[model samples]
Target: MAPYASDDSTTGGEVDEQRSGRRKAARYVVPVTVMGVAAATIGLVPALADSGDPDLPKITAQQLIEKIATSDVQQLSGTVKISTDLGLPDLGGLESSLMSGAAGRGEGGSSADPTAKLTELASGTHTLRVAADGPDKQKLSLLENAAEYSLVHNGKDVWGYDSKSNEVFHGTASESPKHEKGKEQQPPATPKDFAEEALKAADDTTSVTVDGTAQVAGRDAYKLLIKPKQSGTTVGAITVAVDSETGMPLKFTLTPASGGAAVVDAGFTQVSFAKPAASTFDFTPPKGAKVTEEKDAGKGAEKGFGKGFHKGFDKGEARKHAPKSEEGLGKGLGGMKTIGEGWNSIATFDTGGEGVPSGKGGGDLGGFVDSLGDKVTGKFGSGTVFSTRLVNALITDDGKVYVGMVTKDALVKAADAGK
Candidate 1:
């Protein structure tokens, strides 16, 4: 049930600086984190059990919110299962297309098909084993069929291993080199992390309630229900199951506005609050495996699973084909900005033609993006609007990208307003 560090251990000037930094970081990171997780889990659907609601003392919404906000559990290990059903087309076709392109290039590196790896994650139920001893030591392992992919954070070093590819990625990052633990390192993909992000949206636009108690991971828990009061947002509500004894979040679920079932549901099947073994964070790449090293791994280590793989594995290969405009755009996420606030907030960015395949060797990815959504034309100009059960993304012909959990009409309006 324990995940992510929200330490309020500073005083005076340091406190003010840390708070300011957190606000700025959240503004940029949370939106992309939400959108990226949703996009990746297009077909994932978790299988959660119903053991009946447990009887417990009543608690208010604000109380539950505060409980989660101030949870200080430092160490734990757990198994998380994630399932999402976004009602989008299967990405298997695109995976094949990208893999074919990779093979054609005669690339046999350890991280050959980064896009393909993400597509594979989209289709199935994903089980992750996560352990965290403290802020500086943590581990996340994606349990695949007979194979495991792991990322370990031990002291100043981060290690990633792909068992199937037999490839290892190592990066060195110092914990708050300048600020003395003032910065919050990016947490691994987990329900607790997602719950904390969702909690930030519980402002004037959201209605939060404590909807009784339930048993999660064999522990008695309280259910925190958060609903958006505004329209145009695809998110109907987010349910977070928090442990009763400890304030830690055990599960997080997001349902669509036009709801049938939850679009994304992630929860622990097994959890232990005890500190994980010291050796858990210690890792060594296999003898015959190819190894890639990054001197500054702080940024790359933040991305979860497949994205982290691409950032580390294809770091060299990508630079060759990357456009100069993209090189500049990469500095600040291509002028990315949010147009609104809370549930209906829209994130707009300049793609610099990153999504469109340009060269002769490029495969059917252009066709793939073109196939997903209808061609839309408006005051903002012509573009393609791609949608899933919970998100809508508009890619303009002029290389602008607009994404939100709102309807296509709302997204277009936002785009027009921006233009």
Candidate 2:
């Protein structure tokens, strides 16, 4: 009887201990099971990565481009910052002024800021073209027009058309200078022309790396880094964020090659890529505006020197003796027989003025004057003269031909000749 009781008590104690252990485990098991399910669901449905191949799928440049080319278009509007080597004067101020002026003019429903221009181009409606004085100036004017390329979806097969010059240029993905020149060399077939040209001329490209994920234009995007392959080739490496859903490039940054130093950056906002109307590529020359094919006249003329010479001549005795006439200033200057046919505006001169002595030596006058001619040629192809210089040639911007210079004395002589 004593043994039985002892055994029974021990069994009871063991049963109670087992029950307590099971209760403790039950307390944790429910929460643990829930957590396990949550983790498994996350693993199955992967969250977007920041910028890597695993997080972001690999894509070829051509594939990315095709997506943009074929996407449906709706209205797009946003702000963007473009970077280029062109020397624009106070771009921020210029943008402000343009905005105000456009508001006053009230031309279209368009906004005046360059950021607005990007949206306009992306909209794929009217041709968003820029009319620059010349190519070198055009390069710098990217910001002035808002760092955006006009979109053309019309059936006319124009991608990078220059309506101002009535021309088209095309390009390929191959990295070669032979194809990167301009509309004169490669008539643009589509927006891809601009990208291809830019990539071809890129000094060095880094190993492409895809970062994680982010939102751009309210869409998921993958960031990519393209560093310059060579050292000191560009300011730095450029990183671009492409939309994973639409495959359109969303944001791009250019870091300075010298580590953290950077000169400029550009971005696209409120972006969309879509097929445009059949008329988007259609353009007609303004009734009186002349449309001429662009010619490769080599690098544009240098600035500063030519304008400086003009300023110097203005201060010198030459100003006093310069033949003057009621006709335009160009006519008066053209009256000088020594002045040649291609002379445009004198860019610079060192006249003995104010503090300076008389007959101050002209510094590199030939180069200075020659640059003026080059500028004229660049604008209108080898022969267009500035209106000021046209007075001598008896030529007018309207294509009128004249002879003899319009000198102040010539006016008197003309009066006498008439008499």
Best by lDDT: 1
Count of backbone clashes for each model? Answer: 5, 44
lDDT per prediction? Answer: 0.67, 0.33
Query: What does each candidate score in C-alpha RMSD?
Result: 22.3, 21.6
Candidate 2 lDDT at 412 equals 26
Off by over 4 Å in 1: 1-51, 93-109, 112-123, 175-187, 295-332, 354-364
RMSD of 1: 22.3
Per-residue lDDT of candidate 1, residues 1-419 (tens digit): 34536753333597777897787687899889999888767645342345468888888988888887777777889999977676766555554455434322332333422322333443347898988876777787889889887777777777778887888776655533334231133234567766766777778988999988989998999999988899998888889999988888899888988979877788999999898999998888779887766533222232233234333222212211111113212432547677887777877788687633422112465765576678889999988887878777788887888877888999899988988
**Total clashes in model 2, counting residue pairs 3 or more apart in sequence or in different chains:** 44
lDDT value, residue 78 of candidate 1: 92
How well does candidate 1 score on lDDT at residue 200?
70
Residue-level lDDT for 182 in candidate 2: 36
lDDT of 2 by residue, 1-419 (tens): 24644323323577886876786678798999999999987876554332324345666655554554454323233334444221122335444333333222232222211222232221112222222121111111122223333322222122233333433332112222243233322111122222332344333233544556666555677665554343323234555666677554556554543345333234554444443233433544345433222122111110121121222222211221122211222322332222211111111211222111111222353233233321222222222232221122212122222223232223223223322
